[model samples]
Target chain A: MFEGLYSALEQSEVITLYRHINPDCDALGSQWGLATWLKHRFPLKRVIVLGHQKMTNGLFPDSDEIDDETVRQSLAIVLDTANVRRIDDERWQSARQIIHLDHHPQIEHFADLEYVIDHYAATCEILAEFFSTVDQEPLEADVAEYLYRGLLTDTLSFKTSNTTEHTLAMASYLAQSGLNIPQINRDLFDVPLKEYEFASAIRAEAQILDEHLMISVIDQAFLDRWSMTASQAKDQVYQFGGIREIEIWAVFAKDHDDQRNTWWAGSLRSKTLPVNDIAMNYRGGGHKNAAGCKCLDDASLNALIADLRRRLKENQA
Target chain B: MFEGLYSALEQSEVITLYRHINPDCDALGSQWGLATWLKHRFPLKRVIVLGHQKMTNGLFPDSDEIDDETVRQSLAIVLDTANVRRIDDERWQSARQIIHLDHHPQIEHFADLEYVIDHYAATCEILAEFFSTVDQEPLEADVAEYLYRGLLTDTLSFKTSNTTEHTLAMASYLAQSGLNIPQINRDLFDVPLKEYEFASAIRAEAQILDEHLMISVIDQAFLDRWSMTASQAKDQVYQFGGIREIEIWAVFAKDHDDQRNTWWAGSLRSKTLPVNDIAMNYRGGGHKNAAGCKCLDDASLNALIADLRRRLKENQA
Candidate 1:
């Protein structure tokens, strides 16, 4: 399945890598790992990594600049991204050929070529398998470190449901290259004092509504108080995650919209319940266990809560 | 080194397993894992697991009950614990023979036969290595699940400084036995709503003293308000851990001693500083990065803070 992708990498004079916007460690890891691997294997090839938004962890390198002409003549590999809208660099569409590699379920057939393994824990896992199969050159420690970061972060260090025997095997194979697991972990997980403080405030504001549904509202005032943007505050909703009693959890942060109506955008997560469909109904969506959505007003928020409560009851039954 | 222990297991008709007091998942997993393996291997033999304080996670079964006479005739194997004071069961002393299987450094030699590997990620990893070596029988999935739990929790899902290539290898070995990684992860890590709420209170109460040290003080009143014990509230100190900019972090929870002295007992953590010696000076001790101490009064707390500040200055200098 990866043969075509491998061939393209070998044939192309220039390669560009693009990850999803607002990227997580997995996205950055895959992007950087592939770029490093390509640069090491084909020293003469020009491999560039590009992304718009900077990662919050500050672990990976900054994005590189490439002109439209360069991209038009390059092989573009979009990594850890599910759809076209998420591709950080729109120039990928203008590339000579596009290869989409992802671990998410096939949502849209937008890519020219796709390598989607929905059951795999991460894109790095798929790449690990590809590297082992290609037999051109063994994965080096430097490249392995970046790939391992993706595997570790995407599975939440192998705590996610998609984690399997193969996940550990791939991780062990990468570790054989002497990746610094502990240092990478600390670099990715360690938070700043301000982030920790903001997380605490989010937790304090969490409410267990309807005995099973958890909701946390961070209005504009709260965001201003913390000097944080809506996305910055809503990201802390993960602090409310992994709770046993809360069947479904959501964090709504009111956007500082200049329009006549105030809107609240947020993220939602669940351990066993289905929240993606609910999020989709509210003009946002994601995986079954995790999702996101936005509401125009307080009434819509209440309705979403009611719908979530109904879903929780149905799931329990 | 495991020759004598394997012989003892084969010879003994009654076997008792012991773990450390205030047991964590590693302690419980090693205890139950070895017991389950032995029970399956030697069906005629009696296997009992004994512990005092139950684990907060409540993922495993309750500790079994056995009288002193039974222990006296059994081969007792203690897991995870480093010293005699931490042994949960006193009857282990009366056992016909004692075997210590631990991953911690050799602090005090109390057992007759010791299998201690300080560099191993978890006691369960040691057991996994032992199982592969014994060759009499293979490790079953049921036993592997318990071992996997220990490996997962002890290393914080393989993020701890001690995690090694062998750690990933041992975990992969266990996963090969069909362990449910995701379910076990959720069972172990999922927090209760009340605990999450209390963690927020701890964070809200956090203080940045001396511009580098972070502290969260939970008085008796605060504990009462949360309906939590001093230890429970103090555990929230982890909420402040792995944060950048804070040289040292501490959680001081007021404890009402029976002797009419109001003491403050707490846990201390640091990202790049040594705090154990200072903690030892305050009537407690632990590793260089993590430690604990108890103070008898406000003056003692102030003195400890001053000492920490001085230590920080010295470290910086």
Candidate 2:
């Protein structure tokens, strides 16, 4: 994983980390994990993470706020990033040197030095291996905590096909670092009562798609009536019952308050159909198991549905 | 929502229903929404729920199971159950009548009359208007959908101390439907994920109560490391970033694999010491903000933790 990191570290004076936009747990987890490790390891160089906007992480931590001056003078290390468009901040062009570390399936790398490990479960897992390999010093509990967070998210609590033995070993290594498991479990999963109810409500709306699949949606009225914010509605979409190979789920919701913005968000969770490819039609992407995209309006949505049906039929064939 | 409900609509011949355990979501959403309506409206006395486990039903529609002989001779009704424990198996008890319905929370309410409304905001909101008044049927898509699954959980989807005017309005009208919203939301909202995570690993691990009402668990590590099942250890817990509020947030987790299991489950969610009242001592009860008991281990875990310094201070003075 540290193929060129040693040379980059030696040659670079400043480093800024980057991850995919919307800042999922793994992205931010790996970004922050690396920053914390580097900040302590390379006390001589300035280190920072760039581009974090948590549609889900409200007041959680690591704001999207970036320092214009930092990127201009530092080396940029992108974590868990797949595409350039999703870069939370676009100011990394000014970086003196760039390093990329990720676990998404092979996508074109953008940085000067790319360390992509798609076979691993999470970016955090990769970072954990990197941290232990560098062997500069022991990791703090909090740092281990963040790395573990990334590992957990990408693995879907270890339920995803992307996970491997290497991932668990890295997690075990992190656990050995004196990290507190219960504390992270609570913060990471502690859904508010409202969120639970929201989940229940939408789960109530779930309708079995194919015999093996279930799908549901939260219309604007439903969201308004429940007093749900955007993220809550987004989360509640996954509460359908019975997860099987045939389980294909979708949630179509109007984005925000703008009527003109008929943005629909869906979660495709199954080994059956690669929903990510469907998501690619629009300006969205993720792992083959889980991906997303946006649609402009009704016409596009219908066309997308037809295309999805045809592709699904082809898969069945 | 239920335009063609229990009436002499040619003797429903066979009907079954279900609800969340500990009875919440205006229990009637399943018990009353279908059972009573069917008893008064449909014919063919074959009616019953599916199971017979015991739990709190939040009191929306209480148990409505029947006997084996009755299954051969009459109709049955299963009320306010989100799980298999409260199924009116008398239907199966009799084999002639079978039906089920419910606002499936995180917990699955497996049943025959399984018309689960997991997407609506509340079960009671989907029932009538208030706790006691059963007339009229759900009509508007919003109200129908909202009440279709409203008020079956504790967070009350805007109920509790954190409720709003619209929440009450929707609930009040639903209450006027001769169904109860309070009991439904209350019962359904028994143990949230965060509380479970906290109670399981965080609070049990440590009970330090300082003067400023401070109680800190070992941050995110415990959560990240703990597993729900032997199979799930490979899967890490929730993965997210910034790792905020670790210094001081309530924690809980469950000894059982299912987070929804009530008997030996744990809970911990609060900002200050006031949470102790809910985390009570006797009869396994306490105030609203906090409360916990042994969900499933069959041991007096509460008493065990009661001796711990932080909680020991709860009943003192």
Candidate 3:
């Protein structure tokens, strides 16, 4: 399945991996999983994994610091990314070649050589297939642990619709490689007492947006005390769980490091809300139920809210 | 997609809905959504919702009940069931006719007229398709709200792998029916402050299995003080968020009414472990990550644990 992808990278001596902004496990897993595969397969080649944005620190417990200019005219492979605007590093523009492997429905094609499989469940699944297909050595436990985590995280542990027999088979195969399922689970799920308290604070801060939506924007003031990634902030929103009727549950957290003051990070969810369409309006994107975007100020955020109300109004029609 | 299912139930005059035990919103929504559809489209016939077990009461703010005798006499329509033996009502044996509609993977060949579309996102998706085929009235606000709940609960509010385009579409369609999403959310997700303390207590009680699987079983003593449901207990287990490697995280709460000594209950998870299979071996059954069974005593539960460890060990081999 990845024959063309490998062939494109075969000639390149140096390789780097990148993912989209607000990097999810799939994006990180694909990037990291492939890095593990390639570095192990071709030890002679230099491999690097880097993304432009900061990932959820809690999820990516292991990291490799990369110098953007380190890969002299090498190949860069972007995995589990969508639009080019969200690409982790612009250094790819200086690379000699670029390849893309993703499972998302296409929005914009970014790579010179793209290997997108919309049918696959997760990006890690694709990477696992790549390693298995080429008869590469079996995954090392820590490497297998990361790959498995990506699969479990992306598939919500095989509870989602995207889970296919292939996903399960790959997970089963990874388990066979002696990746400890329970320990990985504990590390991923064990929460500190403070985190629980922070989640309560978020829930207490959240409020309803009409009967159809719930909205909360966690300003830096509320979040400064609690160290968390955007995804952690997003996951905290589910704690006020059981909002079945909510077409959209939104969280806009202020990221102070953002040089663009107007670029307040926003997260949206809706079983009924066409949030991706709304996010697109803000020059961001995601699926219908979960999407994110940015707003410059209260004025812009209010304008976005007005637009969302109109979308909710459309449902009324 | 539903032609085969339509024919099996076309001639039936009476239909009774069934869902898995300890019902969630999706379970209820699947049941209520179908009952509402029948109420309007087949007004001449009688439709009832019945289950072999009662749901966790506190979670469901409203009551929708039926007697077992109804299942024995009517055309039993089981909804959202995962396994055959655990079919809510044993009345399936004597029911004049039996029809099954479920979203879980095929577990058994119990239903004489079964519609098992495991690939569909939620049980409500199956009902949505069935209603669309039957030309049922556009969903009522309450019915639509209930259906939306079922969809959200089962789909984990569009975050799980089970979510599909159809899942979102059905949620959108239901949103048009005007049931309050935020209100339902508040009722569904908002646990009392007391429950938080209870959750803390439960977490403290959990037994760690090498940081791989964490098991916590609360007895009746905990229940009386907190007045929490098994569903709430499960939510507490899921609250430990962020570990990427743990496989099985379970909350086995005692169901006081089950028997004098046998503790009847099961576990819920994010598909990290195969607890359902473990539950099945103990005369219980469920899905890959979510399953329940009874432990007549601590020794029985320990034997069950031994079996699970054996399976995980086999996987490593």
Candidate 4:
């Protein structure tokens, strides 16, 4: 299964890893896990993890920077990204060769060798399986921890629908490296008191439109009180999740254009209803159950909510 | 390991199962899991689960009520309770024979046969291992689901300190029964909108005494707003957990005596500091990191907080 990827690694003296922009734990996990393994297995190889965006949680180290000459000569292996447009470092287009390793559905592929397994819960799951099978020795603690973080977050601590027996088996395999499981979970999940306060505020201020729908609107004042960006505040949409009565939850955080015109950046989630269609209607899009969009004004926001309520009603019917 | 428990099961025609008062998932899971297994394995044997308290969440069915004559004739099996005093149904003493299975440290030997393995993450973990090994065929879906619920809750979805590779392996074994793991997790954890609002209120109302300590005081008025009892309110203490700065967090809910005099019931938790000593001083005690206590007045609550602060200070020193 890993023949082409393994041969590419063995053939390339210089390898640079990249992942999607606004990288999550799984992206960083798969990128660094494979890099760490490559460096260990072939000490002479020049391996680099290249990305412009940072993991804001401080769970991972910063990405490496290389000159254009190095990018032009390196084997650029992209991890956890579905398509070329989302690659954090566009310099991958200039690399001597490209290999895409992803768990997302196949999009417009640009890699010389594309490997996408959508059924896997996380990109790190594939990497863990690959690493464990390619060698007889157990993975080092650092490598296992890096890969495990991605698996943990992407699967939402194995609470997501895609989590399977194989997922737990892979987790058990990674855990055998003596990684501190509780501490890692704590590091990835444990929030600061301020964030807790923010979540509390979100829940407190949330407007329950009906038994099936809930919404939280974060304006400039709310953002100022929490000292966070609109995007960051929007991330608290999860606070509305896992409520039995709330089949659909949305968060709208007020942002401004370059001209300082008011706009609302919105995130939408559902238990089973499709949301990406509504997101696309507002010049934004994502998956069926979870999506993102924008609103130009209060009327647009109201329209968005109305559209979601309609979707819920349609689903009920 | 199986010789004693299995022989007792085989010899008994009527078996009564008991667990601790105000039972959590582990207690109920172990009791019902064993009862269900025994009933399936021996169709003629009557297995009854006896408990007075209800699982407020409705995750498990209500306990059975049996006549004293049945208790006196049956073999009583106590699961998940550490000591005799805490058992929900005290009629176990009258049973013809008694068997105790628990994962807590052995407090006393009240049962004729005791199986205590403190290292296991949950009593359900021990039960799962026992059931899987004793039978070559896979456990029925209902039995595996019941036990899996306990293991999942006790380990906090495998995030607890005690969770090991064996825990995941046991979970995998349970998953082999084609259990709907995601649905079980959802049922075990998903809360109603009102509870979400209450959690928000707790976080909003929490007082950060310092970087190391946080407290939330819930009065009768607050309980009335939520339409929940002080004990039910106290269960929200977990909302204060998993915070990076707060080494110790607590919740004190006001309850009244028959005379209408107000008192406070408190739940305390710490990341590493011991709070049981202070709890013992306040007419209560529990594990080192987690404990419960009572305060007669505001001054006593202050004193308890002071004691916790002192413990944290000592640890830092």
In terms of DockQ, the best-performing candidate is 4
Give residue A113's lDDT in candidate 1 (0 to 100).
84
Model-by-model lDDT, in order?
Answer: 0.85, 0.53, 0.68, 0.88
Q: What is the C-alpha lDDT profile of model 1 across A152-177, one tens digit per residue?
A: 88887788767887888788788778
lDDT (Cα, tens digit) per residue for candidate 2, span B1-317: 34333332245565555444434345534354444444554454554544444444333333454545545544334444555555534244454444344444537533344435554444554344332233455333333323434442423233233222233445434433333332332234334333333333432343334422223223224545753432121111111111232222333333444564433334433433454454455334444445443342435544534344344255344
Tens-digit lDDT track for model 4 on B235-269? 89998888889899999999887898889999999
TM-score of 1: 0.90
- Candidate 4 docking: what grade? medium
Q: Whose DockQ is higher: candidate 1's or candidate 3's?
A: 1
lDDT of 1 by residue, B48-159 (tens): 9998788756678999998889999998998999989889988899999999999999999988899999999899999998887885444788899999988988888788
TM-score, candidate number 4: 0.92
Q: TM per model?
A: 0.90, 0.49, 0.52, 0.92
> Candidate 3: TM of chain A?
0.73
- Report fnat, model 1: 0.76
Model 1's chain A TM-score stands at 0.88
**Interface RMSD (Å), each candidate?**
1.6, 21.3, 11.1, 1.4
- Better candidate number, 2 or 4, judged by DockQ: 4
Instruction: Please provide, for model 3 over A183-236, each residue's C-alpha lDDT reduced to its tens digit, 9 standing for 90 to 100.
Output: 565555556556756665676666666666667778766766787765567666
Off by over 4 Å in 4: A3-12, A68-73, A93-97, A112-114, A135-138, A315-317, B1-13, B65-75, B93-97, B134-138, B314-317
lDDT for B161 in candidate 4 is: 82
